[model samples]
Target: MKSFGQIIKANSVGKVVDFDAGVDRLLPFDFTATNTELTAAMLDDTELFSDWINKQLANNNARYGVGGYNEHRTIYSRSAHFDTSEEPRRLHLGIDIWGPAGTPVYNFYDATVHSFANNDNFGDYGATIILKYEIAGYVFHALYGHLSLASLSGLAENKFIPAASQIGALGPKEENGGWPPHLHFQIIEDMHGLKGDYPGVCRFSEGDRYLANCPDPNVILQFDF
Candidate 1:
């Protein structure tokens, strides 16, 4: 049997997103301590973070700021969600699309709502949605994090969601775990019986294993990042 990543790549044609028409250039964002662009002062303030992101986009002449797959970041320190006695989770596992709040997000392929939840902790996922997809007898999952609270309304388990269907909107600071609006997109090879939530980051030491299970989201988003 082929791995989930290989199957996704085989059917990558007609996936989702219009980078040239709807989306602008996809900027590579760095949140590591070595990156001077994102200051420590901006860590707790969502407004400041959004302003910094906007400036990065403006300076680059891009409409959206993206990247952060397997990236070692220092920005996770604000929340205990990424911290542990052993190691801090700084390696990002998802592809984040930084854009304005309330930007509509679409399902890339035919799927059904598996679960939804509001991880209301500070610097958490806020309103999140997970969808399940089956292809060639192999089942996989997709996660959309940092969504508007309103996006979770009326969602139920196993609800059918068509390809390219507008599913939810990007959330703002007050509702999206106190961060700038962005879509945390991830493809999961296995849910591990999880729902509505999954680790979008992992420790640097576990990069190989975590990355193998969570493949590049560009397989679905099709963004040339």
Candidate 2:
């Protein structure tokens, strides 16, 4: 049997977020501890963090900022949602495409709505959706997080969603878990009986385990840069 990455490479998938590298530029962002420019104060204030994001794009002449898979991000320190007394979940498990709010998000493959929910906690996913897919005898799932609340209005479990269909739009800071507007795209090999959400970040110690369950999203994204 082919692995999920192999299956993805064998098949063509659509853009989870509308982007054209040929015409539009994508700036890779760094949220790791080494990026001294992103101070603890700036991250704690959503407006400041958002301003910094926009500045990077403006200065670089890029349309969107993208990155954060397997990254040890320091930005999570701003919210208690990602931290526990025992461990702090700072290692990101998804690829984040940061852009303007209301940017359209599409399905990468023909899929069924496995689940949907508004994970409204501070630093949470906000509006989230999970799509189930079966390809070449392999079954897996894709998760789209930080979506607008309106995206959940007419969705239902088991609903057929065509490839490249517009399923949702990016939500604003107030609605998208108080972060800069971005789509959190993750590929999960197993749902583990979870619904509507899965851990998009893990503690540094558990990186190997979480990274296995959530493969690199770029396998499906196929972005050139």
Which predicted model would earn the best TM-score?
A: 2
Quote the positional error of residue 190 for candidate 1 in Å: 1.4
In model 2, how large is the Cα lDDT of residue 211?
94
lDDT values of the candidates?
0.84, 0.91
Candidate 2 lDDT by residue in tens digits, 101-136: 999999989999999999999999999999999988
Clash counts for all predictions: 0, 0
Tell me the tens digit of each residue's lDDT in model 1 across 99-171: 8898888888889998999998888899999998987777888899999999999999999988878888999
**Candidate 2: Cα lDDT at 170:** 96
Best-matching candidate per lDDT:
2
lDDT of 1: 0.84
TM-score of each: 0.92, 0.97
